[model samples]
Target: MMNKSSQESRVETISEQLSLFALNLKLEQIPISVCAQAKLHMLDAIGIGIASSHYDFAKNILHALMSLQESNDQHYQVLGVPNKLSMRDAILVNGTYIHGLDFDDTHAAGVIHASSSAMAALLSVGQRHNINGQDGLVAYLVAIEVASRIASAANGGFHEKGFHPTGLVGIFGATVLVGRIMKLTAGELTNALGISLSMASGVMEFLEGGAWTKRMHPGWAASSAVTACAMAKNGFIGPRNTFEGRYGLFNSHIDSSNLASLEKCTNGLGQIWEMQNISLKPYPACHYNHAFVDAAVTLRQENAFEIDDIKSIKARISEKQVPVVCEPQASKRIPKNSYEAQFSIHFVIATSLIKGKFTLNELENDTIFDPQILALCQKIEYEIDPKSAFPEFYSGEIEIQLKSGKSLIHREQMNRGSSANPLAKHEVLEKFYSNVERVMSHTAAKKFTEDFLNLEHEKSFINIMNQLKVN
Candidate 1:
C-alpha cells in the first residue's frame, strides 16, 4: 500500500511530469517499433471510424453536431463524409465513429480504448494547423502514452467505481495532445490537464439498455479537451493537484480502499512507452467477451458434436467482468440490439459456437435472433474464475457437456491481440483492410491503406482524411 506521505509527495509532480513529456515529445524521441505500433493502432481506429459512417447512430450524431456548427468559414473534414464541420465538432463525430463499433484498440492494463480519442484529436488539430505528418504522428503517440498510464495506475478501479476509464482518463490525453500540437507552454499544458478533470466523465448506466451514450464517450472527452486547452491558453486557472487533492479525480471517483499510486501516472513516462502495449481488437465487441468467444470457437472447431447434442455449456471469467459482460442474465441472454449483443458474453459465446466464428455480421438483427444461436445461448451459463488474470489478459474458459455424457473444454489464458499474445503486423493490416472495404472501393481502400501505413511522408493529413469519404 502507498503511505500518505509518499502519495502526497508524488501528487504535485504527476501532472507536471505528464505535461512536460507532452510538451517536449518529438518524433525522433520515440522508438521505431513503438512508432510502428502506434501507426498500426491509429490506422485500425481510422478504418473503424470510416465504416461507422454507414451506421444510423453515426448519421444521427452527425446531424446533431451539424446543428451546432458555428460557421462555414472554419471547417474540418469528417471521416467518410463529404460534409465538413467545425474542428471541435469534427473531433466529436470522428471520435464517436472510431469508437462507435467498440472495436478500437485497447490498453489492457488500463482497460481503456486509447487510440480512438487520440486519432480524432490529432487529425482535427493537425489539419487545422496544417502540421506535417511526422509531427502529427508524434502528437498521436503523446496522447495515448499519457492517457494509458493514468488509467493503468487505477488498476481497473474506475470500472469498479462505475466510471468508464476511456472517458474518465481519455480527456487528459486529448488535452495534452492538443496542447502539444498548439505548442502550449509547460504551465499552460499543466493547467489544461487540471481543467480537463471537470470535463472527464462516463458512467456505467449505458449498460442498462444498451444506450448509445457509450459510443459517444471518447468523442465527448476529446471535445471537452479542446475546450479545456483553449481555456488554459487564454489564462484560465485550474487546481494544480487534479488527481491527488481531497476532491480530485481518484479521491472522488474511486473508493479509498481501491486507490492506486498517483506515481503510476508519471513513472517511466518517456522510457517505458506503456501505449506500445495497447491491444487491437479481433472482434467488434466489448473486450471483456473476447476470450470467451475465442474459447467457444476453439471448442466448436475441435468437436464435431451438433448443437442439439449439447446438454449444457458453462463459461468462466474474472469476477470483475461479470457486470460488464455476463449479468444481468436476462439481458445477456437476449440482447435487444447490436450494442447489447456486443457486450453480451452469452450471445457472443453462443454465436461463436453455432457459427464457428463471430464477426461484424453476427451483430446484425437477423443473426441476433438466429434460432440456432438463441438455442445455444439458452444452454450456456457462466461462473466466476477465481484464478482468472483480468485487466491484463482477460482470460476465459468454456466447457460443454454432451447428452452422451461427453465433455469438451477449452481455455484462452491470454486473449488474442493482447501484448503477451500479440497479433502480427499482417493480421492488423488485414483487419484494417476488412473494415475499410465495408465503405471504400477495393482500389480506394488499397491506396488509402498504403498511404496511411507510410503516413510520415505526407505533408498534409487533411488530404489523407479526404480519401475516407464514401462517395
Candidate 2:
C-alpha cells in the first residue's frame, strides 16, 4: 500500500496530468450531444446577461467599468451594452452581470456557476483572437468540462470548508476555455492552471449579510483566468504541479480531495462530455431554495387559496439544508441588498406565493415588500426530512395552512429546468428577447439575438459588437 505522503503526491500528479489532457483535447473530438447542450447553455447565459443588464447592480458594475475602458480591437462586445473592452475586462464585467441576479445555470455535483465563467471567457477571448463560431463553441465546451470536473472532485468539500465553489473552480474553467481559444500548448496550459490557483478566491460571508461581492466573485475569476493565461503565454512560469504539489490546490483548499476522481477528466474524453449535466435555472434565487419556490407555486395553484388565506407556512427539507437556507432568525422580507435576497429562502418563497411567479424584476422591486407577504413570511417554518436528497439534488416539501381549517401541502423532488426537465429552445429565446428588449426595441433585440445565435457563421465579432454601439 502507498504511504500517506506518497498517496498525496500521486494524487497531485494525477490532477496536473488530467488537467493537461483536458486542455490538449480538440473540440472536434467532443461528442455531438455535448456540443448541442453547450450551445443551449451559451444561449441561456447570454439571455440572462442581457436581462440582468437592467438590474441596479449590473448597471452599477457596467458603469464603473466604463470609466476604465481599454483599447477595443476585435474583442467581444459587452452584451446588452454599446461598449467594448479588452478580452479580460470584458469577460470579468460580462460574467459578473450574468450571475449578478443569481439566475444563471448551475451544476448539482460541483456547485460551480458553470456558464457565466465559461461563456464569459469564451466570448471575450474568441472575439479577441477572431476565432470562428465552431471554434468558439468548442472552447466553451472544454471550459465547462474543466469547471464541472473540478467541482465534482471537490464533492461538496468547498461548501463544507466555507468556500464558494463558483469562485474557486470557476477560475480553472475560465483558464481552460481561454487557453483553448488561444490555442495554448499543453505546457503553457499547465502553467496557466498553476498561475490561476494563486488568484482563486470567493467566500460565503456575502451569503450571511447580503453583500455585492457574491456577484463579483465569478467576474474576478474570469478576469484572473484570462490574465493568468496571457501571463503563461508570455513565458511566465508557474508551479507545474499546482494541484498535486506539497501545498497544492486540493490539500490547501479542501479537507481531503480525492485525486482519483481526476481520472474522470480523461475517461471517454471524446465520447462523453460533462457539459450535458449542466442545469438551467428557472428561478432567480439560490439553487438550494428553488425547490421550495417550485413547491410553493404548486401549492398555490392547486389549492386556489387566496393570498389572504395563508395562515401558516412550513417547509420540510433536509437537516443539513436548514442552516444554509431557512435559518428562522434570518431576515427575509425586503433584503438590504441583491445578494441577501438571493440566499433567503423565506423571501423567495413568500414572493412566489404572492406573485405566483418569481422573475428578475420582482426580486429587485421595493414594492415586493407588502405587509401581507411579510406576515406570511413570518409564519413560515422549516422541518428536517432525513431522506431528502439535497446538495446532491435540489428537493423540498412545503406545507401551508389556510384560515379555512384546510392545509395544503406540496412536495418537489427535482427542480424544473434541469437536464431532467429542461426549458425548450423557444423559452430560452423568449427569455433572451425579454431581457434585451429592456434596452433595445423589439427589432433591435431580435436582430441581436439572431446574430448571437448564429455567431459561428459570422465573419467578424465586430459585426455583433457594432450592433450594440450607441449613437
Per-candidate clashes, comma-separated: 0, 2
lDDT of 2 by residue, 6-74 (tens): 643442454355556555676567666666667767877877777776667777887787778755542
lDDT (10s digit) by residue, model 1, range 51-104 = 888899999999998887777754777877787888888899999999999999
Score every model by TM-score. 0.95, 0.89
Candidate 2 displacement at residue 116 in angstroms = 0.7
**Model 1, stretches more than 4 Å misplaced?**
1-11
Candidate 1, clashing residue pairs?
none
Per-candidate local distance difference test: 0.86, 0.74
**TM-score, cand. 1:** 0.95
Checking candidate 2 for backbone clashes, the offending pairs are 12-244, 133-456
Q: How far is 224's C-alpha from truth in model 2 (Å)?
A: 0.8
Cα lDDT for residue 429, candidate 2? 70
